[model samples]
Target: MPSLSTALARALTVTAATVALAGVTALPGAPPAAAAPLPPGVVQLGDGEPCPPATLCLYRDYGFSGPAYGIGAGYAIDLRWLPMPGHGGPTAADNVSSWVNRTAGVALLIDEQGGRTRPLFPGQHLEEPVPLNDTVDRVVW
Candidate 1:
Protein backbone atom coordinates (compact mmCIF):
# COMPACT_ATOMS: atom_id res chain seq x y z
CA MET A 1 0.00 0.00 0.00
CA PRO A 2 1.11 3.62 -0.56
CA SER A 3 2.33 5.62 2.45
CA LEU A 4 -0.02 8.22 3.97
CA SER A 5 1.99 11.11 2.44
CA THR A 6 1.81 9.48 -1.01
CA ALA A 7 -1.97 9.11 -0.72
CA LEU A 8 -2.36 12.72 0.36
CA ALA A 9 -0.25 13.91 -2.59
CA ARG A 10 -2.32 11.91 -5.03
CA ALA A 11 -5.55 13.40 -3.64
CA LEU A 12 -4.14 16.89 -3.94
CA THR A 13 -3.13 16.26 -7.55
CA VAL A 14 -6.63 15.07 -8.45
CA THR A 15 -8.24 18.04 -6.71
CA ALA A 16 -5.93 20.46 -8.48
CA ALA A 17 -6.70 18.89 -11.87
CA THR A 18 -10.44 19.14 -11.25
CA VAL A 19 -10.16 22.80 -10.30
CA ALA A 20 -8.07 23.56 -13.37
CA LEU A 21 -10.56 21.88 -15.66
CA ALA A 22 -13.42 23.84 -14.11
CA GLY A 23 -11.58 27.09 -14.73
CA VAL A 24 -10.95 26.15 -18.36
CA THR A 25 -14.59 25.29 -18.92
CA ALA A 26 -15.63 28.63 -17.46
CA LEU A 27 -13.23 30.66 -19.59
CA PRO A 28 -14.55 33.06 -22.18
CA GLY A 29 -14.80 31.69 -25.77
CA ALA A 30 -15.29 28.17 -24.47
CA PRO A 31 -17.95 26.29 -26.43
CA PRO A 32 -21.24 26.14 -24.58
CA ALA A 33 -22.58 22.85 -23.32
CA ALA A 34 -25.63 23.32 -25.53
CA ALA A 35 -26.57 25.76 -28.24
CA ALA A 36 -29.01 28.41 -27.11
CA PRO A 37 -32.28 29.06 -28.89
CA LEU A 38 -33.09 32.45 -30.34
CA PRO A 39 -35.48 34.64 -28.41
CA PRO A 40 -39.16 34.53 -29.27
CA GLY A 41 -40.59 36.65 -32.09
CA VAL A 42 -37.13 37.49 -33.38
CA VAL A 43 -37.70 37.49 -37.09
CA GLN A 44 -35.03 37.87 -39.74
CA LEU A 45 -36.52 41.10 -40.96
CA GLY A 46 -38.25 44.19 -39.61
CA ASP A 47 -40.09 46.99 -41.43
CA GLY A 48 -39.48 45.27 -44.79
CA GLU A 49 -35.76 45.25 -44.21
CA PRO A 50 -34.15 41.97 -45.08
CA CYS A 51 -31.84 39.63 -43.22
CA PRO A 52 -32.36 36.47 -45.10
CA PRO A 53 -32.26 33.06 -43.49
CA ALA A 54 -29.01 31.07 -43.61
CA THR A 55 -26.99 34.23 -44.03
CA LEU A 56 -24.88 36.49 -41.91
CA CYS A 57 -26.04 40.07 -42.29
CA LEU A 58 -24.45 43.38 -41.39
CA TYR A 59 -26.08 46.76 -41.07
CA ARG A 60 -24.69 50.25 -41.22
CA ASP A 61 -27.02 51.46 -38.48
CA TYR A 62 -28.07 50.21 -35.11
CA GLY A 63 -31.33 48.27 -34.86
CA PHE A 64 -30.42 46.68 -38.21
CA SER A 65 -31.41 49.64 -40.29
CA GLY A 66 -29.52 51.56 -42.99
CA PRO A 67 -27.45 49.86 -45.66
CA ALA A 68 -27.48 46.11 -45.22
CA TYR A 69 -25.06 43.44 -46.41
CA GLY A 70 -25.53 39.71 -46.36
CA ILE A 71 -22.99 36.91 -46.61
CA GLY A 72 -23.88 33.30 -47.28
CA ALA A 73 -22.27 30.15 -46.00
CA GLY A 74 -18.85 28.86 -47.19
CA TYR A 75 -17.64 32.41 -47.77
CA ALA A 76 -14.80 34.51 -46.46
CA ILE A 77 -15.59 38.00 -47.64
CA ASP A 78 -13.25 40.89 -47.16
CA LEU A 79 -15.13 43.99 -46.13
CA ARG A 80 -13.20 45.94 -48.71
CA TRP A 81 -15.19 44.07 -51.31
CA LEU A 82 -18.44 45.50 -50.04
CA PRO A 83 -19.49 49.04 -50.87
CA MET A 84 -21.18 51.49 -48.55
CA PRO A 85 -24.68 52.18 -49.77
CA GLY A 86 -25.20 55.66 -51.26
CA HIS A 87 -21.94 56.99 -49.89
CA GLY A 88 -20.20 57.48 -53.24
CA GLY A 89 -19.43 53.75 -53.18
CA PRO A 90 -16.91 53.79 -50.40
CA THR A 91 -15.73 50.41 -49.14
CA ALA A 92 -17.73 48.94 -46.28
CA ALA A 93 -14.69 48.45 -44.12
CA ASP A 94 -15.20 49.63 -40.57
CA ASN A 95 -18.75 50.59 -41.42
CA VAL A 96 -20.83 47.76 -40.02
CA SER A 97 -22.88 48.84 -37.00
CA SER A 98 -25.05 45.83 -36.25
CA TRP A 99 -25.26 42.23 -37.29
CA VAL A 100 -27.22 38.98 -37.22
CA ASN A 101 -25.97 35.45 -37.65
CA ARG A 102 -28.68 33.27 -39.14
CA THR A 103 -26.46 30.49 -40.37
CA ALA A 104 -26.12 27.15 -38.56
CA GLY A 105 -22.46 27.82 -37.76
CA VAL A 106 -20.67 30.65 -36.05
CA ALA A 107 -19.49 33.68 -38.03
CA LEU A 108 -16.21 35.38 -37.37
CA LEU A 109 -15.50 39.09 -37.70
CA ILE A 110 -11.88 39.56 -38.51
CA ASP A 111 -9.95 42.76 -37.97
CA GLU A 112 -7.52 41.86 -40.73
CA GLN A 113 -6.76 38.94 -42.94
CA GLY A 114 -5.59 36.14 -40.66
CA GLY A 115 -5.67 38.55 -37.73
CA ARG A 116 -7.90 38.94 -34.69
CA THR A 117 -11.36 37.46 -35.00
CA ARG A 118 -14.52 37.69 -32.93
CA PRO A 119 -17.19 35.01 -33.10
CA LEU A 120 -20.84 35.69 -33.78
CA PHE A 121 -22.74 32.68 -32.57
CA PRO A 122 -25.23 30.97 -34.85
CA GLY A 123 -28.72 32.44 -34.68
CA GLN A 124 -27.40 35.41 -32.72
CA HIS A 125 -28.46 39.00 -33.29
CA LEU A 126 -26.99 42.27 -32.20
CA GLU A 127 -29.22 45.30 -32.63
CA GLU A 128 -27.12 47.74 -30.69
CA PRO A 129 -23.88 49.19 -31.94
CA VAL A 130 -20.88 46.93 -31.54
CA PRO A 131 -17.42 48.02 -30.43
CA LEU A 132 -16.03 46.18 -33.42
CA ASN A 133 -18.16 48.26 -35.72
CA ASP A 134 -16.32 49.91 -38.59
CA THR A 135 -13.23 48.06 -37.38
CA VAL A 136 -14.11 44.77 -38.95
CA ASP A 137 -12.35 44.14 -42.21
CA ARG A 138 -13.29 40.54 -42.88
CA VAL A 139 -15.99 37.96 -42.22
CA VAL A 140 -15.62 34.20 -42.41
CA TRP A 141 -17.72 31.13 -41.76
Candidate 2:
Protein backbone atom coordinates (compact mmCIF):
# COMPACT_ATOMS: atom_id res chain seq x y z
CA MET A 1 0.00 0.00 0.00
CA PRO A 2 1.44 3.36 -0.99
CA SER A 3 1.10 6.52 1.12
CA LEU A 4 -1.24 9.22 -0.27
CA SER A 5 1.66 11.60 -0.57
CA THR A 6 3.67 9.10 -2.71
CA ALA A 7 0.68 8.35 -4.94
CA LEU A 8 0.05 12.06 -5.48
CA ALA A 9 3.70 12.64 -6.39
CA ARG A 10 3.72 9.72 -8.87
CA ALA A 11 0.52 10.94 -10.50
CA LEU A 12 1.95 14.42 -10.82
CA THR A 13 5.19 13.08 -12.33
CA VAL A 14 3.31 11.01 -14.89
CA THR A 15 1.13 13.97 -15.79
CA ALA A 16 4.18 16.19 -16.13
CA ALA A 17 5.87 13.66 -18.40
CA THR A 18 2.83 13.40 -20.61
CA VAL A 19 2.53 17.16 -20.87
CA ALA A 20 6.19 17.53 -21.67
CA LEU A 21 5.92 14.93 -24.41
CA ALA A 22 2.94 16.70 -25.87
CA GLY A 23 4.83 19.98 -25.82
CA VAL A 24 7.71 18.50 -27.78
CA THR A 25 5.26 17.15 -30.33
CA ALA A 26 3.77 20.62 -30.79
CA LEU A 27 7.09 22.31 -31.47
CA PRO A 28 7.71 23.70 -34.97
CA GLY A 29 10.41 21.09 -35.60
CA ALA A 30 7.95 18.31 -34.99
CA PRO A 31 5.94 16.95 -37.90
CA PRO A 32 2.42 18.32 -37.66
CA ALA A 33 -0.25 15.97 -36.38
CA ALA A 34 -2.37 15.70 -39.56
CA ALA A 35 -0.50 17.33 -42.42
CA ALA A 36 -1.22 21.03 -42.75
CA PRO A 37 -2.42 22.53 -46.00
CA LEU A 38 -0.43 25.18 -47.82
CA PRO A 39 -1.20 28.72 -46.86
CA PRO A 40 -3.07 30.94 -49.31
CA GLY A 41 -1.06 33.36 -51.45
CA VAL A 42 1.90 31.00 -51.46
CA VAL A 43 3.33 30.78 -54.96
CA GLN A 44 5.93 29.22 -57.19
CA LEU A 45 9.02 31.15 -58.20
CA GLY A 46 8.64 33.27 -61.36
CA ASP A 47 4.87 32.85 -61.10
CA GLY A 48 4.50 36.54 -60.17
CA GLU A 49 6.59 39.63 -59.82
CA PRO A 50 7.25 40.71 -56.24
CA CYS A 51 7.25 44.37 -57.18
CA PRO A 52 7.76 46.65 -60.16
CA PRO A 53 11.09 45.77 -61.76
CA ALA A 54 11.47 43.03 -59.13
CA THR A 55 11.13 39.22 -59.43
CA LEU A 56 10.56 36.72 -56.70
CA CYS A 57 11.45 33.03 -56.85
CA LEU A 58 10.54 30.27 -54.39
CA TYR A 59 12.03 26.91 -53.45
CA ARG A 60 9.65 24.16 -52.45
CA ASP A 61 9.84 20.72 -50.90
CA TYR A 62 7.00 18.46 -51.96
CA GLY A 63 7.98 15.29 -50.12
CA PHE A 64 6.04 16.26 -47.02
CA SER A 65 2.33 15.50 -46.81
CA GLY A 66 1.71 19.25 -46.67
CA PRO A 67 2.37 21.82 -49.33
CA ALA A 68 5.94 23.10 -49.40
CA TYR A 69 7.21 26.60 -48.63
CA GLY A 70 10.57 28.22 -48.15
CA ILE A 71 12.26 31.57 -48.33
CA GLY A 72 12.00 33.13 -51.79
CA ALA A 73 14.42 35.07 -53.97
CA GLY A 74 13.55 38.50 -55.31
CA TYR A 75 15.26 40.58 -57.99
CA ALA A 76 14.78 43.77 -60.00
CA ILE A 77 16.09 45.07 -63.31
CA ASP A 78 16.03 48.54 -64.79
CA LEU A 79 17.24 49.55 -68.23
CA ARG A 80 18.29 53.04 -69.27
CA TRP A 81 20.23 54.56 -72.13
CA LEU A 82 23.53 56.28 -71.38
CA PRO A 83 24.38 58.97 -73.87
CA MET A 84 27.35 57.94 -76.01
CA PRO A 85 28.56 60.50 -78.50
CA GLY A 86 29.33 58.22 -81.50
CA HIS A 87 30.74 54.85 -80.33
CA GLY A 88 28.42 51.88 -80.16
CA GLY A 89 30.35 48.54 -80.43
CA PRO A 90 32.30 47.57 -77.32
CA THR A 91 30.63 50.46 -75.54
CA ALA A 92 27.31 48.71 -75.91
CA ALA A 93 28.58 45.62 -74.11
CA ASP A 94 30.11 47.79 -71.39
CA ASN A 95 26.82 49.59 -70.93
CA VAL A 96 24.93 46.33 -70.63
CA SER A 97 27.40 44.96 -68.10
CA SER A 98 27.19 48.16 -66.09
CA TRP A 99 23.44 48.01 -65.98
CA VAL A 100 23.58 44.38 -64.95
CA ASN A 101 26.00 45.20 -62.14
CA ARG A 102 23.83 47.96 -60.78
CA THR A 103 20.67 45.91 -60.90
CA ALA A 104 22.44 42.93 -59.36
CA GLY A 105 23.51 45.04 -56.41
CA VAL A 106 19.92 45.91 -55.72
CA ALA A 107 18.83 42.32 -56.19
CA LEU A 108 21.40 41.16 -53.69
CA LEU A 109 19.69 43.11 -50.97
CA ILE A 110 16.31 41.86 -52.09
CA ASP A 111 17.46 38.25 -52.04
CA GLU A 112 19.80 38.51 -49.08
CA GLN A 113 17.34 36.84 -46.74
CA GLY A 114 17.27 33.70 -48.92
CA GLY A 115 20.79 33.80 -50.39
CA ARG A 116 19.52 33.10 -53.88
CA THR A 117 20.13 34.86 -57.21
CA ARG A 118 23.73 34.76 -58.28
CA PRO A 119 25.56 36.22 -61.23
CA LEU A 120 26.28 33.98 -64.18
CA PHE A 121 29.90 35.07 -64.12
CA PRO A 122 32.51 34.16 -61.50
CA GLY A 123 33.40 37.68 -60.29
CA GLN A 124 29.94 38.82 -59.29
CA HIS A 125 28.55 39.04 -55.74
CA LEU A 126 25.30 40.27 -54.20
CA GLU A 127 25.11 43.64 -52.43
CA GLU A 128 22.87 44.25 -49.43
CA PRO A 129 20.73 47.28 -48.50
CA VAL A 130 20.87 49.65 -51.52
CA PRO A 131 23.92 51.27 -52.96
CA LEU A 132 24.11 55.05 -52.35
CA ASN A 133 24.86 55.79 -56.01
CA ASP A 134 22.08 53.71 -57.64
CA THR A 135 20.15 56.69 -58.97
CA VAL A 136 17.50 55.92 -61.56
CA ASP A 137 15.95 58.03 -64.29
CA ARG A 138 12.36 57.11 -64.94
CA VAL A 139 11.41 56.28 -68.49
CA VAL A 140 8.34 57.90 -69.96
CA TRP A 141 7.02 54.50 -71.00
Candidate 3:
Protein backbone atom coordinates (compact mmCIF):
# COMPACT_ATOMS: atom_id res chain seq x y z
CA MET A 1 0.00 0.00 0.00
CA PRO A 2 1.16 3.52 -0.71
CA SER A 3 1.92 5.77 2.23
CA LEU A 4 -0.76 8.33 3.10
CA SER A 5 1.12 11.19 1.48
CA THR A 6 1.84 9.21 -1.66
CA ALA A 7 -1.79 8.27 -2.01
CA LEU A 8 -2.83 11.85 -1.58
CA ALA A 9 -0.32 12.99 -4.18
CA ARG A 10 -1.60 10.39 -6.66
CA ALA A 11 -5.16 11.49 -6.10
CA LEU A 12 -4.24 15.10 -6.65
CA THR A 13 -2.36 14.23 -9.80
CA VAL A 14 -5.34 12.38 -11.19
CA THR A 15 -7.66 15.28 -10.50
CA ALA A 16 -5.22 17.57 -12.26
CA ALA A 17 -5.09 15.31 -15.30
CA THR A 18 -8.85 15.26 -15.49
CA VAL A 19 -9.00 19.04 -15.37
CA ALA A 20 -6.34 19.42 -18.04
CA LEU A 21 -8.26 17.13 -20.40
CA ALA A 22 -11.21 19.47 -20.04
CA GLY A 23 -9.32 22.04 -22.10
CA VAL A 24 -8.35 24.85 -19.76
CA THR A 25 -6.09 27.36 -21.41
CA ALA A 26 -3.44 29.80 -20.26
CA LEU A 27 -3.46 33.53 -20.96
CA PRO A 28 -1.73 34.55 -24.18
CA GLY A 29 1.75 36.09 -24.14
CA ALA A 30 2.71 34.64 -20.79
CA PRO A 31 6.03 32.99 -20.16
CA PRO A 32 6.15 29.56 -18.55
CA ALA A 33 6.33 29.74 -14.78
CA ALA A 34 9.68 29.28 -13.10
CA ALA A 35 10.69 27.46 -9.93
CA ALA A 36 10.83 29.66 -6.84
CA PRO A 37 14.13 31.34 -6.22
CA LEU A 38 16.35 29.22 -4.03
CA PRO A 39 16.90 30.58 -0.55
CA PRO A 40 20.23 32.46 -0.30
CA GLY A 41 22.41 29.36 -0.15
CA VAL A 42 20.58 26.88 -2.36
CA VAL A 43 22.50 25.93 -5.49
CA GLN A 44 21.46 24.48 -8.83
CA LEU A 45 22.33 20.88 -9.70
CA GLY A 46 25.47 20.15 -11.74
CA ASP A 47 27.00 23.48 -10.79
CA GLY A 48 30.44 23.84 -9.17
CA GLU A 49 31.88 20.47 -8.06
CA PRO A 50 29.57 17.60 -8.95
CA CYS A 51 28.27 15.19 -6.33
CA PRO A 52 29.09 11.49 -6.72
CA PRO A 53 26.64 9.07 -8.27
CA ALA A 54 25.25 6.22 -6.12
CA THR A 55 24.81 8.77 -3.35
CA LEU A 56 21.56 10.64 -2.83
CA CYS A 57 20.88 14.24 -1.86
CA LEU A 58 18.16 14.51 0.72
CA TYR A 59 16.50 17.82 1.62
CA ARG A 60 15.28 18.17 5.21
CA ASP A 61 13.12 20.96 6.58
CA TYR A 62 14.31 22.51 9.84
CA GLY A 63 11.15 23.83 11.56
CA PHE A 64 7.52 24.86 11.47
CA SER A 65 4.22 23.14 12.36
CA GLY A 66 0.58 24.06 12.67
CA PRO A 67 -2.99 22.83 13.21
CA ALA A 68 -3.57 21.79 9.62
CA TYR A 69 -5.71 18.94 8.42
CA GLY A 70 -4.09 15.87 6.83
CA ILE A 71 -0.40 14.96 7.19
CA GLY A 72 -0.65 16.15 10.78
CA ALA A 73 0.75 19.69 10.83
CA GLY A 74 4.48 19.58 11.26
CA TYR A 75 6.55 22.45 9.96
CA ALA A 76 8.57 20.05 7.89
CA ILE A 77 11.06 21.29 5.44
CA ASP A 78 10.26 19.29 2.29
CA LEU A 79 12.63 16.43 1.65
CA ARG A 80 13.72 15.71 -1.94
CA TRP A 81 15.84 12.83 -3.16
CA LEU A 82 18.47 13.88 -5.67
CA PRO A 83 20.96 11.53 -7.36
CA MET A 84 24.66 12.24 -7.28
CA PRO A 85 27.12 11.70 -10.14
CA GLY A 86 29.57 8.86 -9.78
CA HIS A 87 32.91 7.88 -11.25
CA GLY A 88 34.05 7.20 -7.72
CA GLY A 89 31.68 7.64 -4.77
CA PRO A 90 31.74 11.19 -3.41
CA THR A 91 32.51 11.91 0.22
CA ALA A 92 29.62 12.45 2.62
CA ALA A 93 30.58 16.11 3.06
CA ASP A 94 30.68 16.56 -0.70
CA ASN A 95 27.16 15.20 -1.00
CA VAL A 96 25.99 17.33 1.92
CA SER A 97 27.47 20.50 0.49
CA SER A 98 26.02 19.83 -2.94
CA TRP A 99 22.55 19.25 -1.53
CA VAL A 100 22.96 22.11 0.93
CA ASN A 101 23.84 24.36 -1.95
CA ARG A 102 20.77 23.21 -3.91
CA THR A 103 18.04 23.02 -1.30
CA ALA A 104 19.16 24.39 2.04
CA GLY A 105 16.17 26.73 2.28
CA VAL A 106 13.39 25.41 0.07
CA ALA A 107 10.34 23.28 -0.04
CA LEU A 108 9.66 20.17 -2.13
CA LEU A 109 9.13 20.53 -5.86
CA ILE A 110 5.55 21.28 -6.87
CA ASP A 111 4.52 20.91 -10.50
CA GLU A 112 0.79 20.63 -10.62
CA GLN A 113 -2.31 22.82 -10.26
CA GLY A 114 -1.26 25.58 -12.67
CA GLY A 115 2.37 24.91 -11.77
CA ARG A 116 4.37 26.95 -9.27
CA THR A 117 7.13 26.28 -6.81
CA ARG A 118 6.14 26.83 -3.19
CA PRO A 119 9.03 28.15 -1.15
CA LEU A 120 9.51 27.20 2.48
CA PHE A 121 11.72 28.36 5.34
CA PRO A 122 14.91 26.25 5.10
CA GLY A 123 16.50 22.83 5.66
CA GLN A 124 18.83 21.88 8.47
CA HIS A 125 20.67 18.61 8.86
CA LEU A 126 19.21 16.21 11.40
CA GLU A 127 22.39 15.74 13.32
CA GLU A 128 20.69 14.04 16.23
CA PRO A 129 18.93 11.56 13.95
CA VAL A 130 22.46 10.79 12.74
CA PRO A 131 23.46 8.59 9.81
CA LEU A 132 22.16 5.19 8.82
CA ASN A 133 22.56 2.68 6.02
CA ASP A 134 19.49 3.54 4.01
CA THR A 135 18.54 4.62 0.52
CA VAL A 136 16.06 6.98 -1.17
CA ASP A 137 14.51 7.64 -4.58
CA ARG A 138 15.27 10.69 -6.71
CA VAL A 139 12.75 13.19 -8.03
CA VAL A 140 14.97 15.58 -9.92
CA TRP A 141 18.53 16.00 -11.17
Candidate 4:
Protein backbone atom coordinates (compact mmCIF):
# COMPACT_ATOMS: atom_id res chain seq x y z
CA MET A 1 0.00 0.00 0.00
CA PRO A 2 1.20 3.52 -0.80
CA SER A 3 2.12 5.68 2.15
CA LEU A 4 0.06 8.81 2.87
CA SER A 5 2.94 11.04 1.74
CA THR A 6 3.23 9.12 -1.51
CA ALA A 7 -0.51 9.50 -2.17
CA LEU A 8 -0.35 13.23 -1.45
CA ALA A 9 2.64 13.62 -3.81
CA ARG A 10 0.77 11.82 -6.57
CA ALA A 11 -2.28 14.07 -6.06
CA LEU A 12 -0.10 17.17 -6.22
CA THR A 13 1.49 15.98 -9.48
CA VAL A 14 -1.91 15.39 -11.04
CA THR A 15 -3.13 18.77 -9.86
CA ALA A 16 -0.06 20.53 -11.27
CA ALA A 17 -0.44 18.78 -14.63
CA THR A 18 -4.14 19.65 -14.81
CA VAL A 19 -3.43 23.24 -13.92
CA ALA A 20 -0.70 23.49 -16.56
CA LEU A 21 -2.95 21.98 -19.24
CA ALA A 22 -5.64 24.49 -18.29
CA GLY A 23 -3.08 27.30 -18.88
CA VAL A 24 -2.85 28.42 -15.27
CA THR A 25 0.39 28.53 -13.28
CA ALA A 26 0.20 26.34 -10.18
CA LEU A 27 2.45 27.74 -7.53
CA PRO A 28 3.02 25.78 -4.35
CA GLY A 29 0.26 26.61 -1.83
CA ALA A 30 -1.12 29.36 -4.00
CA PRO A 31 -4.66 30.55 -3.43
CA PRO A 32 -7.42 30.07 -5.97
CA ALA A 33 -8.27 32.72 -8.51
CA ALA A 34 -9.92 35.76 -6.98
CA ALA A 35 -13.16 37.30 -8.18
CA ALA A 36 -12.77 40.27 -10.45
CA PRO A 37 -13.11 43.73 -8.99
CA LEU A 38 -16.46 45.47 -9.41
CA PRO A 39 -16.71 48.39 -11.76
CA PRO A 40 -17.65 51.89 -10.68
CA GLY A 41 -21.39 52.17 -9.93
CA VAL A 42 -21.92 48.60 -11.08
CA VAL A 43 -21.67 45.16 -9.56
CA GLN A 44 -21.10 42.41 -12.10
CA LEU A 45 -23.53 39.54 -12.15
CA GLY A 46 -22.41 36.58 -14.19
CA ASP A 47 -21.04 38.78 -17.00
CA GLY A 48 -23.70 41.47 -16.59
CA GLU A 49 -23.09 44.93 -15.17
CA PRO A 50 -23.42 44.94 -11.39
CA CYS A 51 -24.81 47.36 -8.85
CA PRO A 52 -22.74 49.24 -6.35
CA PRO A 53 -21.23 47.10 -3.62
CA ALA A 54 -22.95 46.80 -0.21
CA THR A 55 -26.21 48.13 -1.61
CA LEU A 56 -29.41 46.65 -2.87
CA CYS A 57 -30.17 48.55 -6.03
CA LEU A 58 -33.39 48.40 -7.97
CA TYR A 59 -33.72 49.79 -11.44
CA ARG A 60 -36.79 50.81 -13.33
CA ASP A 61 -35.47 49.42 -16.60
CA TYR A 62 -33.30 46.56 -17.68
CA GLY A 63 -29.51 46.88 -18.02
CA PHE A 64 -29.49 49.09 -14.90
CA SER A 65 -31.00 52.05 -16.67
CA GLY A 66 -33.83 54.39 -15.75
CA PRO A 67 -34.75 55.28 -12.19
CA ALA A 68 -32.75 53.68 -9.40
CA TYR A 69 -33.74 52.73 -5.86
CA GLY A 70 -30.80 52.05 -3.58
CA ILE A 71 -30.94 50.60 -0.07
CA GLY A 72 -28.15 50.18 2.43
CA ALA A 73 -27.10 46.81 3.75
CA GLY A 74 -28.63 45.05 6.81
CA TYR A 75 -32.21 46.25 6.45
CA ALA A 76 -35.36 44.39 5.57
CA ILE A 77 -37.18 46.84 3.36
CA ASP A 78 -40.85 46.92 2.50
CA LEU A 79 -40.98 47.85 -1.15
CA ARG A 80 -44.12 49.85 -0.61
CA TRP A 81 -42.07 52.38 1.30
CA LEU A 82 -40.13 53.16 -1.88
CA PRO A 83 -41.82 55.40 -4.39
CA MET A 84 -41.18 55.84 -8.06
CA PRO A 85 -38.49 58.29 -9.08
CA GLY A 86 -40.70 60.80 -10.83
CA HIS A 87 -44.15 62.12 -10.09
CA GLY A 88 -47.21 60.04 -10.99
CA GLY A 89 -45.14 56.87 -11.24
CA PRO A 90 -46.03 53.68 -9.39
CA THR A 91 -44.41 52.66 -6.14
CA ALA A 92 -41.36 50.41 -6.09
CA ALA A 93 -43.57 47.59 -4.96
CA ASP A 94 -43.95 45.29 -7.90
CA ASN A 95 -42.15 47.80 -10.07
CA VAL A 96 -38.54 46.66 -10.03
CA SER A 97 -37.46 45.78 -13.55
CA SER A 98 -33.95 44.76 -12.59
CA TRP A 99 -31.83 44.49 -9.46
CA VAL A 100 -28.30 44.09 -8.12
CA ASN A 101 -27.49 42.73 -4.66
CA ARG A 102 -24.16 43.69 -3.13
CA THR A 103 -24.86 42.89 0.48
CA ALA A 104 -22.82 40.45 2.54
CA GLY A 105 -25.66 37.98 2.89
CA VAL A 106 -28.24 36.63 0.49
CA ALA A 107 -31.16 38.91 -0.25
CA LEU A 108 -34.70 37.79 -0.90
CA LEU A 109 -37.51 39.33 -2.87
CA ILE A 110 -40.89 38.39 -1.48
CA ASP A 111 -43.87 38.43 -3.79
CA GLU A 112 -46.68 40.63 -2.60
CA GLN A 113 -49.45 38.63 -4.17
CA GLY A 114 -48.41 35.01 -3.61
CA GLY A 115 -45.77 35.13 -0.85
CA ARG A 116 -43.23 33.54 -3.17
CA THR A 117 -39.57 34.38 -2.57
CA ARG A 118 -36.50 34.64 -4.75
CA PRO A 119 -32.97 34.55 -3.44
CA LEU A 120 -30.20 36.90 -4.56
CA PHE A 121 -26.73 36.14 -3.36
CA PRO A 122 -24.07 38.72 -2.73
CA GLY A 123 -22.70 40.11 -6.02
CA GLN A 124 -25.66 38.77 -7.97
CA HIS A 125 -27.26 40.92 -10.61
CA LEU A 126 -30.51 40.43 -12.45
CA GLU A 127 -30.45 42.26 -15.76
CA GLU A 128 -33.58 40.83 -17.36
CA PRO A 129 -37.12 41.52 -16.34
CA VAL A 130 -38.04 39.09 -13.62
CA PRO A 131 -41.29 37.17 -13.33
CA LEU A 132 -41.69 38.83 -9.96
CA ASN A 133 -41.55 42.26 -11.49
CA ASP A 134 -44.39 44.43 -10.27
CA THR A 135 -44.94 41.76 -7.64
CA VAL A 136 -42.14 42.16 -5.15
CA ASP A 137 -43.46 43.45 -1.86
CA ARG A 138 -40.40 43.22 0.33
CA VAL A 139 -36.60 42.86 0.31
CA VAL A 140 -35.16 40.84 3.15
CA TRP A 141 -31.76 39.59 4.16
lDDT of 2 by residue, 11-124 (tens): 766766675567532433433444333333222322122221222222111111111112113322221222211122211111211221212222231122233333322222
Residue 92 lDDT, candidate 3, scale 0-100: 17
Clashes of each: 2, 0, 10, 6
Error of 1 at 88 (Å): 12
Candidate 2 structure, TM-score to reference:
0.20
Mark the regions of model 2 whose C-alpha exceeds 4 Å error after superposition: 24-141
Error of 3 at 48 (Å): 10
User: All candidates' TM-scores?
Assistant: 0.58, 0.20, 0.20, 0.58
Worst 10 residues of 3 by lDDT: 64-73
lDDT, candidate 3, at 113: 29
lDDT of 4 at 79: 67
Q: What is the lDDT of residue 20 in candidate 2?
A: 58
> Model 4, 123: alpha-carbon shift in Å?
0.7
lDDT for model 2 comes to 0.27
lDDT of 4 by residue, 35-74 (tens): 3333233322332344666888877666776666667776
Clashing pairs in 2: none
Give Cα-based local distance difference scores for all models: 0.68, 0.27, 0.29, 0.68
| Candidate 3 similarity to native, TM-score | 0.20
Residue pairs with backbone overlap in model 1 = 94-134, 95-134
Off by over 4 Å in 4: 1-50, 85-89, 128-130
